[model samples]
Target: MGVTGIGGFFFRAKDPKALAAWYAEHLGVGAGPYGHWDTQAGPSVFSPFAADTDYFAADRQWMLNLRAEGLDDLCAALRAAGIEVITQADWDMPGVGRFARIHDPEGNAIELWEPAG
Candidate 1:
C-alpha cells in the first residue's frame, strides 16, 4: 500500500526532556510520551530543495514549516515571549500565503505559514 502520511518526526536533542517541554510551551507540540501532536486537516507540503538553495541557513539540513491561522496574533505572542520572529515582505506571495520564521532553542529553523483565504 502507498504511504498515507508522515507518521512522526524524530530528532536528536542535547536535552530531550527540556526540549520537549519547550516545544509544548511555545509551539504547543510534543505533548505526550511519544511526542504526539494532534493537528488540523489541511494541505501538507513536501518538497526537497537543491543543495545550494538559499531558502534557509546553509548549515542546516532541514527546516520545519507549520500551517497556521491568526498569524498576526501568534507572531505577536511569540515576540512577546522573547522568541525572535523573522518576517519580510518579499517572503510572502500575493495568493499563496504569509510566512514568518523562528528558531527553536537548539537553533533549528522553523517557518510558520498562514495560507491565504
Candidate 2:
C-alpha cells in the first residue's frame, strides 16, 4: 500500500469528550461514520504523549500528525528514512485500529493509529 492520507487527530483536553462533542457540534467532526472531515486514505496519527515529555510544550497546544495509508508501510518508510518506530502488541487496536508509536526529533511522543473499518 502507498501513503495516501490521514484519518483523525486526537489530543488531550481538560474535557476531551466535551471538546470532541464541541468539535462535533461546532466543527462537526463526530457526526457519525462519515464526519465533517473524513479521511479515506493517507495516515491518521494516534500519538499519546508522556505526561512529562517536553515534546508537547507547556504552551504549545497541538501535536503535529501526518496521516498514512498503512502503519506497516509508513513504519517501513520511517525505518528506511532512519527514523525509530516503536511497536508493541498493546498498541495494536485492531478491533479499533492499528497503531504505532514514535517520537519526533524533539522527543515528543507520536502515535500513528489506523481506525477499523
Candidate 3:
C-alpha cells in the first residue's frame, strides 16, 4: 500500500569505532545489549545536504540528518546535557516541520529534523 519506514543510516567514518563510541556517549545511539535505541517513536527522514552547503561551514567534513519523534523535547534533552545545538531559521519548512543542527565530538555536522506527526 505505502512505504513504511527507514531501516538504518550508513555513513563513512574516519574512525568508525571512536565515532560510534562518541555517538553512544553523546546522542544515545550505538549498538547496545538493549538492542539499538529503545526510545521515542516515528518514521525517520533521510536526506542529504549539498556538498557546498552553507548550512554547515566548510570546516566541517560531514553532515548527518536524524529523524526524531519529539523534536522539541529532544532538543531540550540535548541542550541540558551541555551539547551545542544550533537552530536555523531558514531550515524550517512550513508543513514539513523543523530542523536543528549540531556537531559530533569529531566536528561533523548533524541535521536533526522532525516531520509533522
Best by TM-score: 1
Which candidate tops lDDT?
Answer: 1
Prediction 1 global C-alpha lDDT: 0.90
Pairwise lDDT winner, candidates 1 and 2: 1
Q: Residue-wise lDDT of candidate 3 within 23-50, one digit each (tens)?
A: 8876678558532665456656455767
Model 1 ranges with Cα > 4 A deviation:
none
90 Cα displacement, candidate 1 (Å):
0.9
TM-score ranking, best first: 1, 3, 2
Per-candidate TM-scores read 0.94, 0.46, 0.67
Worst lDDT 10-window in candidate 3: 33-42
**Candidate order, lDDT descending:** 1, 3, 2
Q: In model 3, state the lDDT of residue 51.
A: 81
C-alpha root-mean-square deviation, candidate 2: 12.5
| Tens-digit per-residue lDDT, 4-113, candidate 2 | 55444555557656555544542234576533465454334456766676644665555554334567887887787677887878656655777676655445455676
Question: Which of the two candidates, 1 or 2, achieves a greater TM-score against the reference?
Answer: 1
Q: Candidates 1 and 3: which is better by lDDT?
A: 1
RMSD of 1: 1.1
